[model samples]
Structures are given as structure tokens and as C-alpha cells.
Target: MSSIKYLSAILILVGLSTCGAKNLQEQNTLQQTAVQLTDKTTPVVNKNTATPKEEEEEAIALPPKAPLPSKKDSTTAETFNHSRWDRILQKHVSNSGEVNYDALRNDPSELNIYIDALTHNTPTDAWTKEAILAYWINAYNALTIDLILKNYPVKSIKGIKNPWDQKLWQFGDTWQDLNTIEHKILRPMKEPRIHFAIVCASISCPKLQNKAFTASTLEIQLTQATKEFLNDPTKNELTKDAVQLSRIFKWFKKDFEITGSLIQFLNQYTDFEISESAKANYKDYNWNLNN
Candidate 1:
């Protein structure tokens, strides 16, 4: 009886050890599974990220170089009244091109009305070259003023984010910003005189005429603008053999050179003659608000 009892006790001890070992293995497996699950569910974060503006710019595809042709019947300068814009300019803009942003902002009814009217009118090929040119010129200036008023009290237009690139308004079916109107449409037209015609709300830019550019007066306006810009001693200091021209000349040198030499283009408008061998240097542009 003593030998049988000893063997039974040993077998019982072995069974308990085996059970404990199995339990330990199961516990380890479950722990490993939990760890895997935690890793799978948790997300790692990155410290460096793009800004909202940067992300938005990245997401936008480039617009077409020029606006698409309008399908509607083309309108003439008479049908499209720019007198409203002319009135606004007369009311608020000074002879020297300083704007009353505070006053305009307070009473924006006229500006809003003009912009609404402008949006309804878009140019087509059926329109005369002069009429189309006048339309775009007025469009650019009016839009620029609208943009400034929308973000008034700012020191300079440059202070506004993406001032030139923001497509805040639509022309025809296409959305247009300042850059598109100036570079894509106006520049491609190969009328270098437009450099002076379109005013950027900056001190160094050509003076904003206090009257609208109409098809009938388009030639006169463009000529007057260019002559006034070049002769304005503040903008351009001219001599027979040397010239300190506005940065406009430097920026759009190619545009001016299309038909002839830079001197030739300047001579057409400059009060004094500019020699072929005249040295050209650009003035430092003032980005201060033309207010």
C-alpha cells in the first residue's frame, strides 16, 4: 500500500505542472496578440506639415493661359457702359492716383454696382480690338480697386496674400485674377503700352486715370498714360544719353522691345529724346499703398 500511494502522488504532481505550463503558454500568446492589435490601431503623427494655403495651392490645377471664347453675341462699347466706373474714379480717386479707401469702403454701393455690371459683360472676338482692349483695361483696374476695398485698411497691396494670383472674380466662364488679366490677355495682345495703362495699387505704378478708358478714347488714353508715366520725374528721370526708367520698363522689357528698341519705345512717349546708346537703370519700386 505504501508503494502504490507514492506512485499516485508523483503522477498527481506531474499533471499539475503540465497544466501550469500550458496556462503560461496561453497567457503569452494572448499578450502577443494584444500588443499586435494595439500597434495596428495606433497612428503615428508627423511634426512637419503643409499649411492650409500651401495645400490649397497644391490642390488647384493651373487655369488656362487665356479665357475661353464667349458663346454669346459680342457687345459694343456703347452697350457696355463704363461710365459707372468713370464716376467712381472721379468721386474717390485723386488726380495723383491716391485712393480714398476709407471713404470707398464706407460707401461701396457704386463700386459694387459697377463690378456687377462688369461681370455681366465679357469680351469676344466679334468685338473691335479697341473695344476689347478698353474692356480688359477697365476690367483690370476695376477689379484691382475692388480687391483693395475688400481688404481695406491694409498698408500695401503686397501685404495681401496672393494679391495677384487669387481668382476672386469670374470673366466669361473663366475665373480671373490680376495676373491672368495682365499677363495672359493684355500682354499677349502685344500692346506694350498696356504696361502704363494697368495700374497696380502701388506708389511706383502708373497714375490711375480718374476717367474710364472708352473705345473711342482708348488710343488717346493709352498715349496719355504712357507719356505721363515716362515724363513724371518721380517715375522716370530722363536725359538725352541716360535714363533711369520705372521698374515697369525693366519688368516688361521684352514687351516694349517687340516692335523696336527700348529707346525707340521711350522716344515715342518721353518728353526728351533717348539715344540708342543710352544707359538704362530701374528705380526701386515702392510697394506702399497708393492711398
Candidate 2:
């Protein structure tokens, strides 16, 4: 009977121990399931505690744009008026032949008019034609002088390139070459005096006249210019043995020779007798830009 009691006690103890282990295992599983549920419910955020996805969406919603002009702003006019230009021409002619450095530099509006007249407008009648051509040439020279004045202290006219290019010599509003202006406009009219009238701002260039050239006196003006330039000691000096002449005569020998020999051409305006020997010594041109 004692053996039976001992066996029963052992069996009871084993059962209790097994039940406790099962309970502990169930509690561990419950704790693991609770941790997994908490992990699924939690929200992820940046270190700054703000939603990174929301910040990115806000940045995408707004973008920068260019600023627009004010409603009251005005547009610029491209083409200048002719009547306004005519008034400027009047002022320009009044001060012709004389070098008005200040006026030329200070007044770009008037200067632009002069440039327009030269580059765009054409003289209709014979009288107006001569006047306009003379005006344009004078204006070109005057503007060149004005340009030099602005950049004064420079060694040469080549220092300023805007108007000096051979390509820029065009008719009003039309793109034309200097040769075109010379042959088409000036030559057809038989204005040979232009050879001596238009100054190119070179040491050997014709003297810049003090008075503006007008149609009424174009012929006489050109003639007198040729005569005066040939007679001026600074321009040309002739002696029995030798002659020192403006390098222009040497450079444009073909142009002068077309009408007559260079000596013959000179004789038309100068009283000084030049020998064939003098013509042979025709010196090379000094191309230094005349400021």
C-alpha cells in the first residue's frame, strides 16, 4: 500500500511541473505577439520628427517663375522721324565746316539724325541731290571727328571701329557699299569735286572745310577746295628740282590719271610747275590714323 501511495505522489508532482511549464510558454507567445502588433501600428518619421513624404509633396506643389514687366511700362520706338531729323540737320548745317566737339559729343539725338540722313534718306531733285550728298559727306567727317574727341588721346582713327568700316557706307535704310554711293549717287551727277571735298580723317586727306557744303555753292566750293589744298604749303610743295606732294596723289594716282596725268591734274588748280622727276619720287602714304 505505501509503494502505491509513493507512485501516486510522484505522478502528481510531475503533472503540476508540466502544467507550470505550459503556462510559461503561453505567456511568452502572448508577449511576442503584442510586440509584433505595436511595430505594425507605429509611424516612421525623419530625425526632425516631421513627415518627410509630406515635406517633399509641399516642395513639388510650388515652383518659381519669371517676373513680368509692369502694366504701365512703355515700348521703345525703332524708326526715328524725318521731320525731327530735318530740324537736327538745320542745327548741323548752321555749325558746318567748324569743329564743334562739344555739340557733336553732347547731342546724340541730333547726331543720330545726321547719321540717318546719310545712311537712309535720298535727295530727290538735282538741287537737293547735291545738297544731300554734300551734307552726308560732311556729316560723316564731323561724326568721325566727334568719335575721335570722345576717345581722345588715341593715336589713330582706327582706334574707333564703329563707323570707319568700308562696309558701313550705305544708303538710307539700305545696305549699300561706299563704291555704290560713289558711282550710283555721286558720279552719275558729275560731281568730281568730291575727290577734294570729302575728308577721310587722314594726314594726307583733304582739309575739313569749316562751313557746311550746300547745293547752291557745291561746284564753286569743290573747285576752291581743290585749288586751296594744292596751294597750301602744308599739303603740297613744288620746287624746280623736286616736289613734295600729299600722299593722296600717290595712292589715288589711277583715279586722277583717268582724266589726265597727275601733273596735268595738279596744273588745273596749282600754278607751281612740276617736272617728270618730281612725280617719280612719289613717296609712300603715311597711313597713321588722323585723330
Candidate 3:
């Protein structure tokens, strides 16, 4: 009887141990299932992906289609008046190239009139290349100022959404934006000097000239603009053997290089000669508003 009782006790202990092991196995399986379900339901985000704003900017940065002259437009060379733009620039822009947005915003009638005139008077085949270039350059700068006025109190131009991409002006039947004016229209003209003449309302950009660019004065204006920009110590640190240039040179190096090497191009405007093997470094561009 004693032996049977002892055997019964041992079997009971074995049964309890087996039950506990089975429970632990089931618990582990349940935990694994929970983890798998979470993995399937949870969304994963890749940190390297571009945000919506960046994607939009990338799309806008692409070269736009060049505007063609209207078939109905006359071929007779026509000149667009720039006196209105001249007045606006003179009144608002200071000697240092800073703009007085506060004052301009108060009286925008002149700006409105000029923009309207530009909208109606698109360049035609008859327009001289100089006239067209001048028109677009003035149009670009004026429109940029208008954009700033429309969204006044902004710290920087980039703070505004789609500043370059907004189709705020019309040239003939085609709608245009700042990008179209600079990239498709001006850049294809192969006059790299346009880079200096067209200001993006940034600190490092060529100082906004007080006078408007005109067809008759376009050549002088471009030359002067280039020289002034290169000589501006703030924009370019020039030396005989080494030079630190504005970011514009790096961004538009190809534009400047079309006719010759960058060093050669700089020689045309730089006061001192830069060595052919001179080390070149670019200054960080300040995107702050020119105001």
C-alpha cells in the first residue's frame, strides 16, 4: 500500500510539471502572434523620403517651356516703356540695394500699373533682342517685389510659398512665373550677365539697380551690373592668386563658362588678375530678404 501511495504522489507531481510547461509554451506563441500582428498593422516611415514642400520645390525648379511669340503679334520692332519701373525702383530701393517694402506697400498704384502694362505688352518677333531682354529683366525684378508686397512682413523670400513658381504674370497668351523668366527665357539667350541683372530679392544677389533697364541702355547696364557685382567685396573676395566668390558663381558656373573658363569670365570684371590655378571657394548664400 505504501509503495502504491508513493508512486501515485510522483505521478501527480509529473502531471503538474507537464501542465505548467504547456502553459508557458502557449504563452510564448501568443506573444509572437501579437508581435507579428503589430508589425503588419504598423506603418513604417523612411526618414530619407522627401517632404511635400521639397517635392513641390523640385518640380518647380525644372526648366519651363520657352514662350513663343504670338502668330498674330506684329514683327515690327516695338519697345516697352520702363519709366514706371524706374520710378518704383528709385523710390523704394536704397543705395545699398535694400528695398523699403514698408513704404512701397503703402502705395502700390505705380507697381500695379507697371505690371498691367507688362501683361498686355508681351514681346513679339519684331521686338529687338535688347528690348525683350530688358523687358524680361525688369519684369522679373518688379514681379518679385510685387510678390513680396503681396505677402508683406515675411522674414525671407523663401518663407513665402511657391515664390518662384507662382504664375503671377502673363506674357502674351502664355502665363509666366519667375522661373520661366530666368530659366526658359533669359538663360537660353546665353547672356550670362543676365544673372547679375535679375535680382531674387536676396542679400547676395546683385544690388537692385536704382534705374530701370532699357533697350537702349541694356548693354551698358549689363556690363555695369557685372562689374559692380564682381567688385562688391561683400559678394566677392578677390585676390591675385586666390578668390572666394558668391554662391551665384557656383550655382551658375555653367552659364558663366559658356564663352570661357570661370577665371576668364571673372577677369573681365575683377579688378585684379586671378591666377589660372587660383583656388576658388564659394561663400554661403544668404536667403534673407533684401529689405
Candidate 4:
């Protein structure tokens, strides 16, 4: 009976130990559960957080646009009107820069009005230098057109003997021929680009501008004409060792040399390189009518 009492006492001690172990384990489980709950409840923030609309607004900003330049603002000649010349050109010349010679000849009366305007007008201090230049240009072209009409059904301007020498029109107080207008006035002005602006009604000449050149647009017009003339492969052939230039360039080399050498003047307007050694020769000029 004493041995049985000892065994029971031992069993009771083991049960107490088990209960303590269970309690310790439960305390450890509660700590783990608490740590999980704290992690779930805590909030995480993004450093670059923004609303969708705000992000879109920032991405869509537009820069301010610049204003277009006005032609009228550049115009300094106050009272000179080129609307008549403009009208004549619009009626006779095609968009491709071809003259409708047949139509112009059919209605001689229309062209007479243009000549009348040129005759009555004279360059004065009231006009800007730009306007004066434009006036003479228009006068030259108008007189050329009248001369061709007077001798229409002709193959070339050269067909008429001494076309350039013959005094054809009255300019202000004097009778001026093509040679006088070109060599005496335009050449003396010291702008080589005028060679391109003044068309001779020939295939070799720089294409006649379809619109009248005005003082306001003269700067742009001259630039455009020079570029066009240089780029025409038929007129100017640029190569590695040589430049087959138009007869005009050979005739007016002096004018081109005023500012710089002939090659330098050419390189200014040409896209392709004209080497220093490239010698210039006259390309056969096609003097056929440009009608």
C-alpha cells in the first residue's frame, strides 16, 4: 500500500508539469498571433504617389506658339501699287511658269493697260528704294512682253535684229532699250541676283516669276529666284573638277565677282559642292522661246 501511494504522488507531479508546459506554449502562440495582426494593420506609403488626373495634367502641358511674320509690316513703300502687274501675270502665266503667249497676243488691249501704268509711273523719293527697284523690274518685264507681242510668231528674240539695242519704250523722260535698262540701271545697282529676277523670255533665262514682285516681297523673291536658277541642272552642271554654267554667268562674271569669287558666289546658293579647282565654262544657252 505504501508503494501504490508513492506512484500516485509521482503521477500527480507529472500532470502539473504538463499543464505548465501547455500554458507556456499558449503564451508563445498568442505572441506570434499578435505580431501578425500588427503587421496586417500597419499602412505602407508610396514616395511618389499622385492622383491619375494630376499625373495626366503634368504630362499634357503645351508650349506657346510663335507668331507668323506679316508681309505688310515689311512693306515700306506706301502708295506704290503693283496690283495691275499682279493681275496681268495671273491672267497670262501658268503655275508652272510658262507664258500663255497665244492668249496674251489674242488680247493685246489687256497688256496695253499694264504698259500704260508703267509709262505713267516714275520713281521718286516718296517710294522706298525697294519700290524703286521693283518698279524698274516690272517696267523691264512689261516692255519685253510688248516687244515679243509686236513681233509674235517669231521663234526667238534673236530673230529680231538688235533687239537689245533698239529703243522700244519711254521710261520717265527717256527712251530706254533692254541693254540700257539692264547694263545702265540694274547692273549699276550692284545686286547680282537681279540677273535671275529679270527674265529674257527665253528658255535659257531664269524662269519668269508667275506673280508680280512687290517691294514687300522683293527680298524673298530675289532669294527664291537665285536658288531656282542655280538648281536648274539644264542651266548649271556642277561636277568634281568643272562647272558648266549658263552663258549668263560667263557674260556677267564681273557682277558676281563684286562680293567674292565666281565659285564662292555660286557655292552660296548651290546645295552641291563646287570645288576650288572647278573651272567655269559657258553652257550652250537655249535661246528658244519660253512660251
The worst-scoring run of ten residues by lDDT in candidate 3 lies at 69-78
Task: Please tell me which predicted candidate would have the highest lDDT against the true structure.
Answer: 3
Per-residue alpha-carbon lDDT of model 1 for 140-217, expressed as tens digits?
998998899888888999999999999999766888899999989999999998888899999999989999998888
Candidate 2 differs from the real structure by a C-alpha RMSD in angstroms, to one decimal, of 19.8
Ranking, lDDT, top scorer first: 3, 1, 4, 2
lDDT of 3 by residue, 149-237 (tens): 88998988999998999997776788899998999999999999999999999998899998999999899999999999998988999
Q: State model 1's lDDT.
A: 0.87
Ranked by TM-score from best down, the candidates are: 3, 1, 4, 2
CA deviation > 4 Å runs, candidate 1:
1-79
**Clashes per prediction?**
0, 6, 1, 0
Q: TM-score per candidate, in order? A: 0.73, 0.53, 0.73, 0.71
lDDT of 4 by residue, 199-260 (tens): 88888988888888888899999999899888889888787679889989989889999978
Q: Tens digit of lDDT per residue, candidate 2, span 1-291?
A: 999999999999999999999999999999999999988995554657667877786667777666764433323212222344335445543322333345555776665655666566555333345566665556555456545655764555566554353454455556654445555655555555676776655556666666666656767878898887777776777665577777767765667776767777776776666665563454444445442
Q: What Cα-based lDDT does every candidate model obtain?
A: 0.87, 0.61, 0.90, 0.83
Give candidate 2's whole-model lDDT. 0.61
lDDT of 3 at 121: 89
